[model samples]
Target: MLVALALLGVVCLALGGFSVRLLLEQRRQAALIAQQATQGAALELRLKELGKRLESYQRINVRMGEELGELRKQVANLPERLARLEQRDPASLSFSQAARLAGMGASAADLTQACGLSQAEADLVARLHRGRPQD
Candidate 1:
């Protein structure tokens, strides 16, 4: 009976030692799980902030695209607007140059060649500026 009691004591000690080691390992694992959860929560928050920033950037890009579209429309109309302005001023650069040449006694043909004036415009310049008639 005393021998049996001694063997039982040895087994009990072995089990106690194993249980202590297991408890310590479980505690370590619990601490690691807690740290990882904290990191995950922080990463989630950062991801949400980045998503908000992305949304703001998208809004800004949308506004810029709208403005660019308006600018494109204005640019497309620029040529027609410029044509109307030039039509309003018949005495443009060529006409002025033709008139100066006519005042300097240049013939209608000379005004046409030197100033790129149309034949009718050259004749008008000659008549208005008292230039000599074509021979």
Candidate 2:
């Protein structure tokens, strides 16, 4: 009876040790799980920030594309606009030049020679601008 009782006490001690080991392992696993949860939250926040940055970059890319397209359209129209300017009336150009020369206090003969204006047109411009102060 004494041996049996001693054996029973030894078995109880072993079981108590095993239970303590199991409890320690459980605590360790819980700590690891908590750490993983924290890491996951941080990763999710970072992902959201990256997503916002990507969206901003995409918007900027779209705006730049639109601006580039507008510039291309303007560039394409340049030749036609230049053609119109080249085709403007010779008389109109002469008249404009005559008016500018007359405004500078040029004589009628000077207007006629320099701006290809008719004598009558040169006289008219000279008369019209005679009152303005000279630069």
lDDT of each: 0.78, 0.79
Error of 1 at 97 (Å): 12
Index of the highest-lDDT prediction: 2
TM-score, every prediction: 0.62, 0.58
lDDT of 2 by residue, 22-128 (tens): 99999999999999999999999999999999999999999999999998986676546434533577655465566567778899999878977668766766876
Count steric clashes of candidate 1. Answer: 0
For model 1, residues 1-135, the per-residue Cα lDDT tens digits are 999999999999999999999999999999999999999999999999999999999999999999999989966765464345336566654665565678779888998888776787677667666544433
In model 2, where is the ten-residue run with the lowest total lDDT?
78-87
Instruction: Give Cα distance to truth, residue 80, candidate 1, Å.
Output: 2.9
- Candidate 2 yields a Cα-based lDDT of 0.79
